[model samples]
Target: MALQIFNVLGREKQLFQPIEPGFVRMYVCGLTVYDYAHIGHAKNYIAFDVVVKYLRHSGYNVLYVQNITDVGHLRDDGTDPIIKKALRAQSAPMQIVEMYARSFFEDMDALGVIRPDISPRASAHIPEQIKMIQTLIRKGHAYEVNGSVYFDVTTDPDYGKLSNRRIDAQQAGSREEIRGEKRNPEDFALWKNAEPEHILRWDSPWGEGFPGWHIECSAMAKKYLGDTFDIHGGGIDNMFPHNESEIAQSECANDADYARFWMHVGSLTVDGMKMGKSLGNFVTIKDALKRYRPEVIRMFVQSAHYSSPIDYSDDAVQGVARGHERMMNAVRLTRRALATAPQTDDGNAILAAVEKARADFTAAMDDDFNTPLATAALQELTREVNALLNSGTTVGASVLKAIAETYDQLGGAVLGIIPATDDSAAGNASREAGLIELLIKLRSEARAAKNWKESDRLRDELAALGVILEDRADGTVWKVN
Candidate 1:
């Protein structure tokens, strides 16, 4: 089957088609860079990361752009979160931006998320934002009042098309305050007049001000990915005013459609409650890495559809971790059997299983990226291969090689839950195995020398790292859990 995506624009599963054949242009709204990234951020980015990887694997040249909002992301009370964080820490706004921007990328890298092709910062793209606002004002889609610009929601009759809300149904001044400067309560700011105490300010035709939260995205997406792109994505929480305003203003200013497909990841909750710092349940990416491997985290996220809400808890992630280990063990055992197996005369049963797993994985992915089902296909293959390997028959080298390749392609490349057993990775594995053997030898020597305290310490430490040492009558053997 061909690829299909649940485009939020139409609220249906549509066949995947890019604006240009053999190429895809995509943009996702990035973080505001005021603090460290959390698990919720990990879920959102990992969803898009897999999308980009799958698109490229399907033979499309993809150019992905994500923006960084360093300024002008205002609260409902007209305060910038960056400035608020900076003041609380007694530092400059740019200092806070620089620190957390690095922190955000570090966390994403640890989670195995691929970086975007272009990361345009809002502060660096002021000229482009100013030009777009000027175009809106000249086209009568916006108005300047008291050195500030507001997008006239009434001017664009299709104002709430994306959110499917009528202008009258929306609470006026719900985001921004009701003021005499706005013609209507639902009108949002295109550019805000910076107060004298504002840390981040720029000179514009309207005065010294900054771009609004919504305009920054519209301007940056237009500049990097063109006026219209193939896909635009972000968290579903931003679908209402942030994404809705982006569509209305971009179409009005450029006289073209904004994005062909809109993809939104569902919100992530912690143990059936919203994750928050005040709630004492916030899981930062850094803190999560302390307890779980990056691959484990990726597997937990892929256990659910990208468009479906997921709950994060220790029990949930621990289950995924065990599943990930099962798959990895299958690959490890297959490679070990391949080392001494005969070259020819193999039955086609294992090879057929490999082919069936590949087809099943692709089919699941094609049906709107149904990752849970795709992973189930992998687990099924793992079970079959494990049974074959443990049976009293010698699997041929060619059959084992085929099984390994399928895991590399489907699990490593597509879902990113399994690491490729390439030369480099194999070398690392060999080194780790050597270290464990050496520790076991030292512990054996200590036991032979009747040093009970030191021997017990070494054995306990290795067990802490999931390496169990069994003392048999023949010798000592070790296994990783």
Candidate 2:
């Protein structure tokens, strides 16, 4: 099935057709490395990560590039964000960038957000940015003002195509004097003049200046993924002005579409307001990782569609944690069944149900990478497997292997909700599984022998070890907490 994506360009869902057959080139706007990444950032990257994962799973060779803005991103007062962080920390701006950039990688790794193939930092691509700015100027779409360059939005006929905002409505001297250096108020900066005190400034054709926020992404994306790419994605907040400026500079300079698909993930809120550090309601990715497992957090992010707002709280993550554990327990039970059952006939109701679920999972993923629906299919498979396990009917080894492999393919390989079954994680998991089974057997024997106090004590002991036990009529079920 051809994947369908909601392209923000036309505000409609369209079937995804890459520029090159059998390959996808994707670029996701990355973060400014001034501070630690937050939960809002987590949702943004994970959304694109799943997109890339599913695309690869569907047999496309994907080249994913996510740029890091260590310089040029400015505050409202026209100061570099990294410079501001440097001032606060009593260190150099690059030091702050290095510190947080390392933390960003660590935090995203913890969240299971896959690293991009090319992590092109803006500071590293200074020459490429300068060249793009020069091209915009040579093409008569930009002008210089006192060692700074600005992209003249009026030069482009379809300036507001990506964002619905009109670029033809600016009247000279009719607006506030916010952008005094710009020819038009809507004209975005391509390069900014840096003061002598600024430490991150580089020598450009204009003078000792730095790349603007919008121009960095334009240059980096073109450098790594070429003028036209399959997908360009970021948070919806980047739709206006930021991404809009990128569209103008890239297409005007390269004379081609900037990106075929403009995908934007929804914002994350807290309580009822946007999550921000100044708002004091924001949760850092560091803090959230301390409490929840990475897979639990992935499940929480995948619970809703990518383009939907997520209201985050402890309650939200905890709810998803329970759901994630249930899914993992189902995988464990299927693995157990596979390990012990005899190799015989596979014709059974359970086998048919598992095959149908595998098909459903693929169908759900192909439809705009609908992770919630895909996860639902897996959960249904779990339910079917649990019923078969408790039906008092012997499930053959072939049937159990099919069920386990199906779960591993869709659950672990595609969605990444399940951990990898290779390496030390698998070894440690096996050890834990054996210990958990022993405890379950001891507790079950205590219950059958009418030793109520002994069973309760054993359950309490397991609880202290973070193992949750559910005693069904047929047997005991256990999952790691």
Tens-digit lDDT track for model 2 on 288-307? Answer: 88898878888888899899
Q: Which ten residues in a row have the lowest lDDT in candidate 2?
A: 420-429
Model 1: residues with Cα > 4 Å off, grouped in runs: 169-179, 345-347, 421-432, 438-461, 469-481
lDDT of 2 at 132: 92
Count clashes in each candidate, considering only residues at least 3 apart in sequence or on different chains.
Answer: 0, 0
Residue 154 in candidate 1 has what lDDT? 85
lDDT of 1 by residue, 298-395 (tens): 99998999999999999999999999878877887676667767996474587777888989988998888889999999999999998887675767
Output the lDDT of residue 234, model 1.
98
TM for every model, in the order presented, reads 0.91, 0.93
